[model samples]
Target: MDKKKTLLTLSAVAIGSVIYNYLKPVKSDVEVIQDFDLQKYLGKWYEIARFDFFWEKNLKNVTAEYSMNEDGSVKVKNEGVNITTEKTKTSIGKAKYAGNVNEGALKVSFFGPFYSGYNIVMIDSDYQDALIFGDNLDYIWILSRTKSINEDRKAHYLKYAKDCGYDLSKLKWTVQEG
Candidate 1:
């Protein structure tokens, strides 16, 4: 009986550890922007570059559109073209501020009841460019109001991402269709 009890306790501990790790807020040296203006941020932004991942594999001409939902949540619309298949793909999601609304930290859900962190770490004064980070270091994106960004701005963001421990070699420049 004691042996069975010990096994059960160990199993519970292991499961709990997994859940905690997955649910934990992102711990990183990177900072999240404060005093974020969601109104100005609500619009279409093109993905200038990103870290390649399975979900966005073979995609190009990617763009993310943000709008307000009736229930005070931000609606997210992501669209891209599959270069290999020549098909357009879209994903719709919703985001709510994880912390204060003035902060740029948010929790977004594409799948029902499952949320992930979305942080806007940096933005230009005009709100024309932004640096976005996900729950972990593996997810990062450079976004611009237009389909392409200027060279100087691109270099600045690249440097910042590198300083924050991102792997530049994994960065993929998004193809923008005119």
Candidate 2:
């Protein structure tokens, strides 16, 4: 009888923990701006830094261009030169407001019906720099209007990302030319 009671109590505790975690308000794992103006954000952006990802391996001079689509979704064009192959590669994708248009959270699909989170966590008032993070916290990108950002600004963003529990060591500094 005691063994059965102990097993039941353990099961109850495990279930309780799962429920509590699910009910808790989400934090750092995924944070986005209150409102993101797609029009104001449209244009060219340089990839100053990013976490290592298979799609962009050994790439340099990375750039992303955002354009408005007639269907109300955002068109994304990413271009980069393969350092080893000396060839330019491009990937086109589409993005839509992940939850609501009022939030900076977006769902970007590179493949059909397969979307991933593209949350803009921080952006400068001038729209010159932005910190983009993924919902799973495995992806991160520091983007700028120019090919490079100032050391001060880079340091500030690094600190911000670290505070948010990102592994800064995983970042790959991008090289770009004007």
Q: Which predicted model would earn the best lDDT?
A: 1
Q: If scored against the real structure, what TM-score would every candidate get?
A: 0.85, 0.82
The C-alpha RMSD in Å for every predicted model, in order, reads 6.5, 10.3
Clashing pairs in 1: none
> Which window of 10 residues has the lowest lDDT sum in candidate 1?
20-29
lDDT of 2 at 107: 84
User: Candidate 2: where is the Cα deviation over 4 Å?
Assistant: 1-28
Score residue 141 of candidate 1 by CA lDDT: 90
Candidate 2 matches the true fold with a TM-score of: 0.82
User: Mind sharing the TM-score for model 1?
Assistant: 0.85
- Give the clash total for candidate 2: 0
